[model samples]
Target: MSTSSIKFYDRFSKLYPIVDVFLRPQKRRLFEEINLLDHGKLLEIGVGNGTHLGLYKKHALIGIDTSKSMLSKAIDYATQEMQLLHMSGEQLEFEDHCFDYIVLSHVIAVVEHPEKMLEECCRVLKKDGSLILLNHFTPNNFLGYIDRAFQLFSPIFHFKSAFYLKDLKALKKIELKEQIHFSRLRYFKLLIYKKP
Candidate 1:
């Protein structure tokens, strides 16, 4: 992530509540999927305010973020089962193939280099491990054009409005295991990938 991107998130951390209002409905399914997951070391990139930390009971979750303000907000959700770290997803600090699962929730498009982030995720993930991605990947329809239009203002918001799953270079190393649409508008998708 860039310095400006980090600054934007730190400054706008308080606005997440308003963002949450529209996001909560979709997040219900996201959390449901996560809550049912059985895993070992799991990394949740961009853990935001950590409101969903309690939802994860069967996994040892380690959440990482580039913003200190966001990490501070997520502190309250920390537990023996979960650890919060101030780190960049594009450059993870852990050793190779350490995590059993990596969850990239609503984060791929917001980073400065989405591909680099995925590369890091894949690097740290064990072979045969799952990478769960919950993101807004643009479709080929009118809704996609709408997202593309918003790309102009994405810099001001620090996120891409028209990110596509095909643009992810990390796909070369991972196989798409499942793709599910959870949002009411089918704008956001939950993609499960397995590293070969």
Candidate 2:
């Protein structure tokens, strides 16, 4: 994340909790589409305000975000066991293949370099571990062009408008386990991929 991006999020942090209310339904659907069992170490990249902390209580949880304001809110909301780190997804400070599971919730679209971030993610995830994604990707149609056009406003929206699942370079190393689309327009999707 860029310094300006972190500043933008810090400014937006106060309202993020309220904004997340509309995201609850999709969040619920994401969990329903995947199985989060006794995986030992679970890392949530861009864990905004620790709103999903309750979901991974069974695992040793680590949450990372770039915004200090957001991380502060997360600290207030998260249980003591959950470790909150002020970090960027593109440069993860972890040993190779250390995590049992990695979760990206509405994060890939906003990252500066999605491929580099995914490369870091793949490097840190243990072989046969899971990578779960909950994001809004461009559809493969005319609407996608419209979505791409909307990239002009990404600075205001805080995420790129044209990010697609097909753009991920890490896909070649993982097998798609399940995909569930929740939006009426089929824009929002929950995807689970297993590292090979």
Candidate 3:
């Protein structure tokens, strides 16, 4: 991540709680997908402000993000049972098959290398564990053209790498047991990928 990007999120951390209200419907679905996991250690990447941490029930939970400012806001909500790591998703610090569930909400789009991140997610997941993702991507229509146009002129404003859309199409090849798209067509997508 660039210094500027880090700064953007640092500033964003302060306003995340208020900003999250607009994302409630999507967040609710994300929580619902997370609830499918029975029990065990859970790892949430890009866990900004740990806003949804309270919704998860787990014996051990670890939240990781590159932004210290974001993690700081989450400190109060995180108990001794939950751990927070200031780290990036591309280079996860965990060992193979370490976590029972991994949540990648709104992360794929912003990552510099989405494939490497997914590879790491797979590496750290226990056998049969799940990877939950929520993201916004180009629609498969005229809206997609608008999305591309926006990407051309407002690349920095969008900040998402082009591969985000490609990854959505490549989910099957990655060995996901299930991939479901939820939400209205153009704006958001929710996916559940269970490792085999």
Which candidate leads in TM-score?
A: 1
Per-model TM values vs. the true structure: 0.95, 0.93, 0.87
Deviation of model 3 at 151, angstroms: 0.8
TM-score of model 1 vs. true structure: 0.95
Kindly list the per-residue Cα lDDT of model 3 for residues 11-108, writing each as its tens digit. 87887888688777788877776776687888989988887778776547899998899999888888888999999988998899998888888877
Q: Which stretches of candidate 2 lie over 4 Å from their true place?
A: 33-35
**lDDT of candidate 2 over 109-169, digit per residue (tens):** 8888889988999999999888898888899877798898898988686789988778687
Pick the winner on lDDT between candidates 1 and 2. 1
Selected candidate, larger TM-score, 1 vs 2? 1
Give residue 105's lDDT in candidate 3 (0 to 100): 81
lDDT of 1 at 15: 90
Worst 10 residues of 3 by lDDT: 161-170
Model 1: pairs clashing at backbone N, Cα or C within 3 Å: none
Ranking by lDDT: 1, 2, 3
Index of the highest-lDDT prediction: 1
